[model samples]
Target: MIKRILLALASGALFAVGLVVSGMTQPAKVMGFLNVAGIVDPARFGPWDPSLVFVMGGALLLMLLAFALTPPSRQHPERKPWLADKFELPTRRDIDSRLLLGAALFGIGWGLVGYCPGPALASLLTGGLDAGVFVLAMLVGMALARRWIGRVAA
Candidate 1:
């Protein structure tokens, strides 16, 4: 348990640092990078930022490596995670209305504010008002979504 907690802390700190260093904590940078439509139009390409492409690509590569490396805990008890006893993975593979609504909401929020939950929380260390407000709003939205999605799913 202690090892797992420590590993989680270390992982979170590293993620926060990556968010800051990758310019993800900056709303303008994120907004610029998210402007994919502008990239297709030469006239509107000025606001588009391509720097984030590398960051996302590296993340995807790392995730692919990790997923490919990890095996089923049931058949590989000796190869379980170093920090935890077992993997707590999602077994559900089928997509539902809940998944669609959640993804839509996430994309809308990111496009409008350029602050996903990770970067928004990481930006709080810089004492930015926008990040603070965004985090607050995100929390409230999460609460509302919990109750709302529950009803919808039922």
Candidate 2:
């Protein structure tokens, strides 16, 4: 349990660092970029704020490096434990109303909040009263849904 707590804290810290470094913490910047205003005020930053491109490139590069460094899984390992497992795609083909409704709800929430689940949690940790409310409401919604599902299943 202690190990899990430590791991969660470490992961949260890493995510917070990523959010800060990526400028996701700044809603104004994201909103401004979305607005597409023609002002282009380069004077404010003065060549220092290459936040967007650098963040994306760095993430992609890191992912590439990780994939390259990791060796391919072997079916029959020379060691005790086998490295490979059976792989298969989802067999469910039906696009039920639940999936569409969930997607629509998620989109509506995101459009209104400007903070998705991960970033909302990050913002709550980093400091945002709005984010705190959002997280609480999100948890309530999740709990309600789970209760409803349990009742239905029962």
Candidate 3:
């Protein structure tokens, strides 16, 4: 149990580091980048303020390189415990209403708060009161949702 807890914490620490390094922890910067309104100021530094695009492109390039280096199933048919199964696919056939509804809610929250689920948890490590409040509210919302869904099912 302790080992699992430590592993989880380590993973979270790494994620937080990633968030900080990627500049996702700054709410104002993220909001400015998302809303496409970063270039109007006469005191602005660049012609287009393309820092966000460069960061995103670098992330995408890293992901693509990782995918490219992964060994293909055709080369090694045996499945490893740490690696996902080669032929595993989603069990769903059609787009479910629940999936769509959840995605819409998530997107709206992200847009309004400039903080997605990952970044919210990562922010807790920085020991800020806003992060604490956001996390508490998020947990309460999740609990209420679960209870309401349970009642509806019954």
The lDDT for every candidate, in the order shown, is 0.88, 0.68, 0.72
**Candidate 2, 150: how far from true, in Å?**
2.6
Please write out the lDDT profile of model 2 over residues 54-146, one tens digit for every residue: 677888999787656655456523222122243235999989887798888887776566666777777876787988888899999899988
lDDT of 3 by residue, 1-154 (tens): 6765787789778768888777787666666666644366525632433566887788799868766676656666553222444546588788877779988998887778778777888888776787688789889989998998899789
Steric clash count of candidate 1: 0
Higher-ranked by TM-score: 2 or 3: 3
Could you tell me how far off, in angstroms, the CA of residue 124 lies in candidate 2 after the best superposition?
Answer: 2.1
| Candidate 1, lDDT over the whole model | 0.88
TM-score of 2: 0.63
For candidate 3, which ten residues in a row score worst on lDDT? Answer: 78-87
Model 3's alpha-carbon lDDT is 0.72
Say which candidate scores most in TM-score: 1
Which segments of candidate 2 are over 4 A away from where they belong?
1-9, 31-58, 76-94
